[model samples]
Target: MNALQFIETSIEDGIGYIFLNRPKQLNALNRKMVREIVTSMEAFDLDPQVKVILLTGNGKAFSAGADIDEMANDNPINLELTNQFADWDRISLVKKPVIGAVKSFVFGGGFELALSCDFLIAASDTQFSFPEVTLGVMPGAGGTQRLTKLVGKMKALEWILSAERINAKTALQYGFINKIVAPELLMEESVDFARKIAKQPPLAVRLIKESVNKAVDLSLYEGMQFERKNFYILFASEDQKEGMKAFIEKRKPKFTGG
Candidate 1:
């Protein structure tokens, strides 16, 4: 826990929960919190029992971005800050799928954090924005790249330049959120989704995530070649055989993560 000062972690039913615990600060991302998040994610990746990870907040806001107090007088644009942003890029590359259970405000760094996840479940009232421009800065996190990929260049540019807040429904329309649930059902729905995914073969899930992520940056032909390589690798796994056999036998496949 020393790695993060404003977050709490818990694991159960093959899901790892990472909670932003700084309610007083609206779950702001400070230096300590970011370090803690990265450390916790590393632990989750190594834990055999954890099949999925959930990122959420403890109170009203999911996260309001960075702690303005810390950056108030310092040089905000520099290599050090850029490295801090790359930490999130690392999070997005974790093999296990991550789900963002977002509610209330998810702005700037918070928005970037949600974007890092493989999927997002947002509350009906949740608000998202890239208000960094209003602060006389830009989203230094993976926002610049990830948001463009998710919502397309035009919409991403409009949102970033306008620094306007969009409602959950609008986010869904723009393909920014995977699903929208009522506030009270956000956690339950997200956990339910995680459970369904966890029941699938773990090795297949890992390979699929890796293949898709790697393919996005490659040419269509190169991406298909990468997919074929992963497909063949998966075909050689015992889990793949078991999966097919179980389906033919109308039985549940007990994956061993092999």
Candidate 2:
């Protein structure tokens, strides 16, 4: 927040962009870097201009993993006292649609960070893994929980326990990622997708995001109840009326986030 040493934030059109800045270290997430990312997203959530947030790394790899040098000498007491993993949870609290446009390597904490986004678009060459077991550590930042929900318990166990890297194609087949573009198309396709979402009815988009995320934590019946409540609540919004009216009129709906 104070100078953004580990990350860079920007706003373009209606998208809030966060670029992991430590390319030389493959954007390895240190405590400070993760904090910077969460703080930037918090700021963007408050800003009216930012309708969507796209996260990408500055260089080839999205992120290699956590900074080994920073935590190798740490103990459990210090770890709990620091509560580093808590920062990862903050990402889910963000209201807007968050899209991860990751490339090359996304491993360990990096893979956890990607899963924190509402969805991901990765490069065809990207390789994802939770290689923490190799280091005698395991994912501490919702990686186990989220990956299990997305890819199922068996696949999660296969990948995490085996410490095997998952290619983009296999990841898409498992439904862990939304899409895979060529390495050259990663940014362009990411922005194109973000821009399309940005043009939608903002309030509806926000509510639907909340509803879908609830599907992950709530039982099927409870999730449907939540979705129904949101659907009814949208009837009170001006955009809801405009969207329907525009449909009847066969014209584009103009949304003002009302």
Candidate 3:
């Protein structure tokens, strides 16, 4: 596997973990880090051995947002650079699920990165915000859109406009994060959760994620049609038959991701 200077990638027990390694800068997302992350995710997506992905950071923060030093420079931000923010979007669209284990700070691009994941397990000490307004800019990534989908439009607007840091408890209340554990146990619990997911039928999980994500933006009729299509498609898959037969035989299904 190719090494990422700003990140670390490893696969164990079918769970692929991509850790932000820039502890010195609080794991802030800069051009290099973002590029590295994109590369890592793409590698994981292509690796059929990887059933799930877990994203986290190594330092005191999950990520302190974008690197302010880059933004402070006089160099113009080009369309290509701005488009790099879609890395998380591509991760979100991957067939395998990505889980975000957040701790410390998750702000700006960091927040969006977590939001891209299908599931989020945050530490109790996690602090989230959309502080781009304070930076004299707005979220150039999918923050504006993804935030509103995770939370409501009003709450998303409040967080962005007020630039208030929300604690993990408040975030859970608003449904921004799925679960919160102690900071000390964040990684352990995240890996445990990913393992549970990995134990399930891979093809089923992939179809479920695809159907749910697509259903959200689609109309009721369209959503139902989409679900029907996926349901039948999966029904014909070898994994589906094996899953049913295994249940009948009172044994755990050994899915080959067929």
Candidate 4:
């Protein structure tokens, strides 16, 4: 499906590709652009053909962050009307797994967007930071919360306070990014990896995503209960029965997402 502007979306091999298409602006996200991205993601989440999503950008940068020009001219009325970050919040509600293929700069809002993804595979030279502090503001999206949860409180504090840009290697060491590849191979590697994930049972995959994401907000015991319930629910799916039967029969299981 085509978004009105800023997003280019396509589906292939069970993988949905969501591209930030504002190359001239380094894919900087204005409100409209952010809305397009959220809308595309929600659409992909509901598309039975799409089991995974690959989010990336089409330019020197994955995204420079929010459109500073748009923010600069905002009045109280327009700011209230825009809802600031209400649309961006919808990204986390996506049930399908979203993998971020990040290159160049992923700053402020861009970093927040990447953090919303289930995992991030970045180019070796990718640089990440939260530069909003420099703008006399702070990350208005999920950056502060998600980054802190991923990298821990001390590191998140340091990064956000200093607005220091870290290379992919450093990000990997900090446990923020999953993998790093050559710039030329970023898309190929990311899509290949996502396709692998797409091969899994779709129902189980969605439940697993929900179970794991709940850990951040739930206590250990509560998280375990949530996991157990999802585990029990999966047994009702035909895929689960087929998977077990296939294992006993020494054959591959064909999942129908039921």
* Candidate lDDT (C-alpha), each: 0.88, 0.95, 0.87, 0.92
How much lDDT does candidate 3 score? 0.87
For residue 207, give model 2's deviation from the true position in Å. Answer: 0.5
Provide the lowest-lDDT 10-residue window in model 4. 1-10
Cα error, residue 18 of model 2, in Å, equals 0.4
The RMSD (Cα, Å) of candidate 2 is 0.8
Q: What is the lDDT of candidate 1?
A: 0.88
Please state every model's RMSD to the true fold in angstroms: 1.7, 0.8, 1.7, 1.3
lDDT by residue (tens digit), candidate 2, 1-258: 479999999999999999999999999999999999999999999999999999999998999999999999999999999999888889989999999999999999999999999879999999999999999989999988999998789999999999999999999999989999999999999999999999998999999999999998999999999999999999999999999999999999888888
Backbone collisions counted per model: 2, 0, 0, 0
Instruction: Indicate the TM-score of model 4.
Output: 0.97
lDDT of candidate 4 over 1-258, digit per residue (tens): 553688898999999999999999989988888888888999999999999999999989999899998888677798788685788778889999999999999988899999999989999989999999999888988888999999899999999999999899999999989999999999999998998899999999999999999998999999999999999999999999999999999999998888
Clashing pairs in 2: none
**In candidate 2, residue 108 scores what lDDT?**
93
* C-alpha TM-scores of all predictions: 0.95, 0.98, 0.94, 0.97
The lowest-lDDT stretch of 10 consecutive residues in candidate 3 is 73-82
**At residue 215, what lDDT does model 3 achieve?**
71
Candidate 1: list runs displaced more than 4 Å.
1-4, 76-82
